[model samples]
Target: MKIIVNAEQRDVSGCTLAKALEELDFISTAIATALNGCFVPREQHAETTLSEGDRLEVLAPMQGG
Candidate 1:
């Protein structure tokens, strides 16, 4: 399936958010995820289903002074 990740097009084989994240190499537990502009809780990633043309945003915390 094809989806937009952080504004870039990507082809993923996973049907669920969790699997997609794994396939995308987003292994950090400290990261945040949003689907189609809606916030998705970490606990729900496994059950969250993704579809073609869906927008997926993955954000990670940044360290700054």
Candidate 2:
């Protein structure tokens, strides 16, 4: 399926958010995810379903002083 990740188009095989993260090499990284403008909690990632044309925002924390 095709989805937008961080403003870029990506083709992913996973049907759930967790699987998609793995496919994108972000499974082990600490990040925040939002689906179609709504926040998806970390605990729900495994059950969150994704569809074609879905817009996802994956945000990683930045370190700064």
Candidate 3:
């Protein structure tokens, strides 16, 4: 299905949030995820389900010296 991922349109599939992440090859080191404005813990990804029109915000950690 076509959905907005971090404000960009992309194709993602699977029955749950965990599956979608796997399908999209979202690496753990690259970002942290918030679904519909709520923070989702890594351990809860498998328990969370993705629904239509749900907004996802991916926050990428930056290194500062």
Candidate 4:
């Protein structure tokens, strides 16, 4: 299926959010997920299903001294 990941268009065959993150090699929980402009909680990642044309945004938290 085709989905927009991190503001970029990519082709993937993942059925769930967890699968997509695994396919993309994302392992850290420091990043936030936004699906189609809605912020998705980290705990819900495993149950969220991804479909064609879905927009995903992975934002990493920044820390400064």
Candidate 5:
């Protein structure tokens, strides 16, 4: 499926958020995610489904102030 990830177009095979993250090599990283402008809790990542044209934002915490 095609989805906009962090403003870039990406082709992912996983339909669920957790699977997508694993495909994108972000499974073990500490990051926050928002789907289609809505915040998605960490606990729900495994159940959150993704669709084509969906906007996904993956944000990682910065060390600097």
Candidate 6:
């Protein structure tokens, strides 16, 4: 399926958010995720299903501010 990840179009095979993240090589635990402009908690990642054309945003904490 085709979805938008951090504003970039990506093709993913996983149907769940967690699996997609794994396929995308996003193994870091220190990150935040949002699906289609809605915040998705860490625990829900495994259950959250993704559809084609969905917008996924992955953000990691940054320092130096």
TM-score of each: 0.98, 0.94, 0.78, 0.88, 0.92, 0.96
Against the reference, the lDDT scores of all candidates come to 0.99, 0.95, 0.79, 0.89, 0.93, 0.97
Ranking by lDDT: 1, 6, 2, 5, 4, 3
CA RMSD, predictions in order: 0.4, 1.0, 1.8, 1.2, 1.1, 0.7
> Per-residue alpha-carbon lDDT of model 2 for 1-65, expressed as tens digits?
99999999999999999999989998755899999999999999999999999999999989999
Off by over 4 Å in 6: none
Best by TM-score: 1
lDDT string, candidate 1, 1-65, tens digits: 99999999999999999999999999999999999999999999999999999999999999999
**Residue 12, model 4: Cα distance from true site in angstroms:** 1.5
C-alpha lDDT of candidate 1 relative to the true structure: 0.99
Give the alpha carbon lDDT tens digit for every residue of 32-53 in model 5: 9999999999899989999999
Output the better candidate (2/4) by TM-score. 2
lDDT of 3: 0.79
Tens-digit lDDT track of model 6 for 1-65: 99999999999999999999999998999989999999999999999999999999999998996
lDDT score of residue 6 within candidate 5:
97
